[model samples]
Target chain A: MLVIVMTSIDPLTLVLAIGTPLYLAAAVLYSIRAVRGPTIPDIILAVDCLSYDLAVFLSAIALYYKTPFMTAPPIMLALWVYLLDIYASKYLITREVGV
Target chain B: MIEQVLFWTGSALFIIGGVFDLLGSIGLLRFPSFYVRLHAATIGAIYGAVLPLIGISLIALGSPGIPGNYTIAGASFVTALILLVVAPMGSHVLAHAAHKSKSVSWKPFVDMLEEDEEK
Candidate 1:
């Protein structure tokens, strides 16, 4: 699989070869912040950044594999992460998760 | 001609997004406070995520060889739009909650929100 992807001269393939590693490095950095954050908001912020980046990654992978099914997950992931932000904020303000 | 244009444009966007992603992540890690890191988060959310999603959609549309390319393009485009609407709102809400709750310690030169609330 690696050899096949590397051999392709497609523009998409070239972009993926360069872009994927950058995204991976970013993900690692975000994870570090998330793990060692001093406050709740810091953790949430790091997580929000990570999730959004992941959505992009997922879409790129879907394109690479030529799979339509994988495209749906990024949207769902983005929606769910937004819900997380809302819920976390609500909890912080009200001191309760429920409405 | 159009396909080549689309492909190259998407490739450029992808590279730009990747660079922004790395920069934002570095800022997120290096920034001293939670409030300061929000700027980095915004960069990561909008440029890092949205741009690449748009690029992916364009690549899908341009690449005829991909199976169900139209579906891939449509879904990625929709995802990018949704993230555009959702990310800032989420960040704002989180920042507001953090401020109100006094969860993070930071030194502000002029805290108008605190001053206003005290009055």
Candidate 2:
């Protein structure tokens, strides 16, 4: 007879287990706001939150998989989202992309 | 001992970040206006995202089981720092744009910017 007993869980695993679901829930709520928001700023705000959250999630996933190369994407995503904010605001204010 | 300390501390931070994320998202959904929702987005950005990235960095540093733990830690830490700086700037720019464009529907009692503009 073979018996497998699970005694202890890895701390990182435990943290990931508890944290990921919460992030997912937050993402879903933000998505709802993005869809239903009446104004463009409201939608942009929701997307901003979503992208930041996604960066966190991606980093955590990279840690989980022990893939160091994967960490690069989160930083890129964050930078690009910042660009999105700047470009969108520029367009909103000037009503044109080029000044 | 150090590994254990890092692991536990990181875990605690990770959990707190998760709670903040949930709260911020709820606030985003329930807030009455776009301007008000900016507060919620700030919460989500600083508390929910940056904190967890820092926590992930700590966890990566502590976990010797991860193959390239140093790389993961460094990357996450840099990402957190970038987010800390970028998030608020983005929020400020967006709010300014929204206000200038008069995209906000709700009127505040103060209207300091409008008053200044008029003067």
Candidate 3:
């Protein structure tokens, strides 16, 4: 009973079901700016922060959609490499123009 | 019943927050410069992601389960708490890094760090 039980539609599912697409759109907007950004660190930060949000968003999806498999990788991406990329990119930029 | 209500309310807030986050991301893409995009990214995470995480936790408390309830509730709670603490701090760090690196050239509004930079 415990393992196989599937809960009925919780209202929260509506949150992720709607939220993910909207957030992705917003992220795309931010990324567009990042793409055109005057400096390197700016793009890096946008990508980093968006990826972090995406991970959290994915976790909610996994819960509502009942798909843990879809959630785990994004979670890992946000928690792990996202920040590193920002840091590494910053270091590179600092070296590039001494900014 | 009360738990269910709270769960649903939290869910709405969470979803509302996520929508903001999405908008923030969209704003990031639409904005002309890095600094402006940063505003979108920060508000997106703060308004969008954090709120939803809290809502998810509230909903989890109402779910019936043996271990799944505990597992989901505990992990989600920790994740929410960590994000609440970390997200803003990360934003601050990123902003500082960008400023130091001069990654963003212009801003449409005044900055607190601008005063800090003068000192």
Per-candidate Cα lDDT values, in order, are 0.90, 0.90, 0.63
After best superposition, candidate 1 residue A41: deviation in angstroms? Answer: 0.6
lDDT of 1 by residue, B1-119 (tens): 89878887888898899999999999999999988899999999999999988988888888877778899999999999999999999999999999998888999999999999999
Write down the TM-score of every candidate.
0.93, 0.94, 0.73
Model 3 agreement with the true structure over B37-79: per-residue lDDT tens digits: 6677777766766676666666666655323554555555566
Among these predictions, the greatest DockQ belongs to 1
Real contacts recovered, all predictions: 0.93, 0.87, 0.41
Per-residue CA lDDT of model 2 for B41-87, tens digit only, reads 99999999999999988888788776788999999999999999999
Off by over 4 Å in 3: A2-4, A7-15, A65-78, A89-99, B65-67, B107-119
Winner on TM-score (2 vs 3): 2
Ordered by TM-score, highest first, the candidates read: 2, 1, 3
Model 1 agreement with the true structure over A1-99: per-residue lDDT tens digits: 545645667667667998899999999999999999999889988988999999999999998887788888899998878787788889889988886
* TM-score for candidate 1 (chain B): 0.96
Best-to-worst ranking by DockQ: 1, 2, 3
Candidate 2 local Cα displacement, residue B101, angstroms: 0.5
